[model samples]
Target chain A: MIQDRLRTRMGWLHAWSGFVFGLLLVCIFASGTIAVFDTELTRWLQPEVPPSATALTDEALEETLPTIRKLLERDEKPFITLPSERDPILRVQYHDGHEFLNIPFDPGTGQELAARATVGGTFFYDLHYSLRNGDTGIIFVTFSGLMLLIVLGSGIIIHLKELIPDLLVLRPFSARLRAWLDVHVLASVPFLPFAFMMAYTGTFLHTRSILPPVSYLASINAAITPVAVRAESPALQKEKTVVPALPPLSPLLHDAEKVVRAGQVGFILFLPKNILISRTDASGPARTREHVDFSYDGHFIRHVLLTTPLTRTQQVMEGIHYVRWGGAGMRWLYFISGLATTIMIGSGLVLFLMKRRRLSGGRVIFRLAEGLTVSVLVGFPLACSGFFWGNRLLSGGSEQRTQEEVTVFFLIWAASAVWGMGGCLMKWRVQVWRSELGLLAVLSALLGPLDLLTRSGGTVFHTPTVFAAVDLIALCVAAVAFQIARRLA
Target chain B: MIVLCSVLWIVSLSVQAVSEPRMLRIARREAVAPALTVRLMRWVSLVGLLLCLYQRPSTALFVWLGSFSIATVVVALGWAWRYRGVQRVRRTGGGS
Candidate 1:
């Protein structure tokens, strides 16, 4: 009787909490999944930048100094990141007051490619962790992550007896409610380890941001300034006075890689009197604080690697979450797991409404919940595909072109929310899902053709694999969406 | 090695499914004790993990866990396909 009471209460908590936050969690997980290939997505977003496989040449590394020096002169914190497997082009990026502006360089020649500016892959990264709202978003997402643990715990407790017994059973052919519950279980139970790992690692990462120690007192200046300006770092300013000609980075990279591991030097941060060459995330599964420092003019300084137990544990956690060392296969694994996880949460949302549709189907609040469901499930995906569309169609000359691409994403999502809610207002829930899904299918199908039409011949010549792979994935998504849309009809 | 690990995981899960009485009944096969089969299945998976660890010690743990989830999903989908086929066979008055 006690266990029964516990299960009953836990069921209510699981159902309500899962539905409430699932609306946001689904989007977060979807975006996080996409972010697994953020580098590839960023490449596809800008068609002008050509991909290369060649290693960085010494001359090319030296050529970037002129640009770096110019940025340094203008009081900017410019840094150089080496080419990685997924992103073949070298990058010179700096904070441009609003965000980091990345300039792609040919690894062989250090010639800057005229890539179009957009948020690119980090858009999804930002969406995944922070919901694009900065610090406030981080705090909110952290709380939601804690709630996710609660929901998962309650759900497991409620279904403890059935978890292992029904582990391999997924009856898609069963009755409607049963099928959805089967899907929810199949998606959740098998991937419970991943769900827990992601939740804990992700939340732990942002724990530092939410902690009170950093801001023992609130910043009054934050309220006074309507527009936040980039503050010049005092260290960088002091370094600017010295302005000594630095040695070629290729040799330093060679030496750094010896300690950091070959082909693992991720980025080079320049200071007035020192240069810090940090190990790239792809170096290993542990994101260690390992770097090799040098004095002005290429004199070798000491190498740094943290070995404390607590720090090692943290580094491993960071590594697990980031998966910077992941290859194509691992990336796809992460992607599928993330999508499956999202589906678990999404199906729970569906089950919540399905369980209640008979009693509250016509209520205003119920209709609103149904609409929000469509917005999150159907609309968010449409907006994702729409982001690619906007990247291609929007003219490149406008200053607000980047913002316009972002606007396109938001506008489509908002419109989807409106369409879903408005249709549900008229009791057209089925019609709304079917129509919007069909639209998503059509748009996603068009992405490939649009890529063929819009992308430069140079980009195609440079990276045929990237162009084809991206288009093929879009086509696959379209095929799935079309089938689901057909089923709903 | 990771590929080998993934294949082993799927095979283990498939073994787990076939050893289940419900699955055997659906397939029209007689049930047997799964104790030995379960032990062998687990050993296969463990050796696969050992091979992965031997190959890439740092990534093996996460990769092992990652492959486990993915492989379980694959087995579940396979079971669904098998179950659906059996159901269709029954509806059409065919033998399981």
Candidate 2:
């Protein structure tokens, strides 16, 4: 009787909590899943740049620094991130608001590429962890992650008796609700380890912002800032002096890679007097979370490793969460696992409403929940497709072209929300779901064609298979949306 | 390699089915006595999967175990569907 009572209480918590926060979790999971390919998506977003052959050599690095130096403002923090497998172009970038205003350069030469200024894959990355609302978003996501952990625990308790059976048995032709539940179990069982890993690691990544003890009390206020904000370092700032010219980065890069045992020098952060080059990309799974430091004039400094057990554990957690060391195959595995998690959340949303709809079909609160469901499930994808279309169609010469692209995305998404809610109010729930999904299908189908038509000089010269692959993925999205729409109809 | 992994997965599930009568409606009485050996073979297949991937053991274990679970689920469902279909055909006395 006690066990039964515990299971019943857990089932209630699992269902009610999921219903309350399912939409937000779905968006977070979906965006995060997509972010596994953020590098590729960023490449796809800007199709005009020619493919880069290799990273900058010593002479090329020396030539590029002058232009990069000219672009730096007195207060601005300038960074040079070397190219990785997914993103071939070297970037001289800095944090703006939600996006990076980066100057892309030919890695082989010092020549700059005229890539259009737009938010690329970084948009999904921002949306995933923080929802681009800065600290509040991070806190909210962290809290939701906690909620997910609770839900996972409760769900497992409720299903513990049948966990193994659930893993092995999937009854597709069973009663409708049973079928959905079986699927939920199937998707959840094999991927439970991944889900728990992501939840804990994701929360840990933003622990400084969320936990009061690790950070100063004022950090709570600082979290409200719209940009990339961090707690001020306790170390005193160096005296203001004339900035010195940088030495050739090639030698530093070679030495840093050797010291850190990382394949590629992912990025170099230039401090007032020191340079910190982080090992962002590594060749294989044994990648270390080590960084190498150097004096301003290129003299080698000591290697910095996460030696403390706590910090090292955190580093390992982050490594598994981000998969920075993994090659393409590993990235694809992350992507697929992420997609499965997304689907799992999505089906849970469906089950939540399906159960509620049967009992209180026309109740005001139920209708509102149904409307929100339609908006989130379909509206976000519609907004993403609009962003891609706007990137291609919006004129490049406008002063606020980047902002305009973002504005277009939000406007379309807001419009879809309003339409979904209005349709629900007017008793057009089915119609709303069908139409929004259909529109998404059409928009997704057009992204590839739009890219093909708008290819400029560099895109025409060097054939980028990445662009083709991206377009193919968009077509696949369209096909999936169409299939869903047909099923709903 | 993907094919080899799939075959190993099938063997793992088949071993489970042979060892445990509850897993399937049709199991030979003699099959139940090989339970210990069959269980041991399942572990061997799992270890083989980890070796075949040739990656960090943690990552390979995560990737291949998840893959094996999915493949097992697929084969189990297929068996269920076939058994149901055969039952239906016998009941109707024809393939109509």
Candidate 3:
């Protein structure tokens, strides 16, 4: 009886929490899965980039010096990123008061490519954590993550005993409820570690931004002033004088590479006072916070390291969560795992609604909830495809093109949401599911051929095969959607 | 070599499952004498996993995790197809 009581209590907590926050969690996990391959997706989004035969060598860096100098003269804080194996273009970027101006160059000859302005993979990355809402989004996401942790804990407690015996038991031919329950358990168990780590580290990454510990402590301490109120660092106080005839960047980059012998230089930041070159390779879980610092005259200053062990450990955990060190294999794994998480959560949501639909008959609130489930599950993917379609079809010369692309995504999503709610109100739930899923399948299948037809064959074909890979994946997704739509009762 | 180890691991898991009373009694089969093969296979599986870890920890972990995920789906589908067809439940004595 006590065991039954405990199970019942935990079940209530798990079901309610999963139901309430499942959609948001799905969005977060889905975006995060895509964000794992953000750079590759960026490349895929912009197919106009010409192929680069040159590598990120000293000679190539030297070739790009004149343009880098020109950019530096124009912008107060211009930075250059050297191409690595994953990203094969040299990027010179600066903030132009409103947003960023990114100029992609051929790594070999340093010739600029006239790539269209598009919000590449960074959109997904920003969407993952912030939902593009800035600080409010981070706070909301962090709260959702915390809830996820709680839900996971309660779920484990509810099934702790059965977990081992039913570890791999998935009885798909059983009753509907039983089959869904089995699938939920099966999906949750294997990816439990990954889900837990991502939630924990993701929360940690946002903790300082929202509820900074130092400031929180200071608020309680009457005698102590907050760190935010502290005097400006000497680094920020450096005078900005016109740097005429600056030293060459290639030798400085060479020196920086020599200092950090293990990793490749990813970014070169030019400040009025100093230069910072950070490691670009995130091929491992544990990454050192090491970067080469240089004086304004290109003199080697110091190699910065994490001073505290605690801070180092935190950074390593953050690195593992962010996954900047991995190559293609690791990234694919992260992506797949993230997709699995979305599936797990999505299946759980479906199961909850299925189990409760009968009991919620004739209830408006339940119908609304059902509509929401359909909108989030089928609608988001629909909107995403719309975004990609806009990227291909929208004129690049238009002002605020990125914002327009984002607007297209939300418009489709909102329309889908309205359709779903309308259908549910009119008792067309099954039709809504079938039609939306069919639309998704068609959109996904067409995405590949659409890009192929629109892109400059000569340039895109010669470039990295990531374009083809994305298209192939879209086709696969289309196939999955068709299967699901066909199988749905 | 990694593929070999993964196969060994799966085989070992199957062997270990057969030793369970629920599984064996459902099959109406007696336990293997001394359970020697099961023990041996278990050790081999462990050793194989360890070898994977020693070589590439991250890859091994992901592969192992993915293996489990695939195994769950495959086993579930296989069981449903083989035994649950034309019936609501399998003959495992556990009602869903």
Best model number under lDDT: 1
lDDT (10s digit) by residue, model 2, range B14-34? 676556554553221343477
Output the lDDT of residue A380, model 3: 87
lDDT, residue A381, candidate 2: 80
Interface RMSD of 3: 3.4
Chain B TM-score in candidate 1, rounded to 2 decimals? 0.72
- Please give the DockQ score of every candidate, comma-separated: 0.52, 0.26, 0.33
lDDT of 3 by residue, A5-34 (tens): 998999999999998999899999988988
Cα lDDT, all candidates = 0.82, 0.74, 0.75
Q: On a 0 to 100 scale, what is the lDDT of residue A469 in model 3?
A: 77
The sequence of per-residue lDDT tens digits that candidate 2 reaches over residues A316-383 is 77778887666666666677677767777777877888887878988988888888888788898889
**Over 4 Å off, model 3:** A50-52, A57-59, A62-77, A94-101, A209-211, A214-246, A458-464, B1-9, B16-35, B57-67, B74-96
- Which docking category, incorrect, acceptable, medium or high, applies to candidate 2? acceptable
What's the CA RMSD of model 2 in angstroms?
Answer: 4.6
Candidate 1 error regions (>4 Å): A73-75, A96-99, A214-262, A271-274, A294-302, A457-463, B24-43, B85-96
Cα RMSD to the true fold for all candidates: 3.8, 4.6, 5.1
- Which number leads on DockQ? 1
lDDT score, candidate 2, position A382: 89
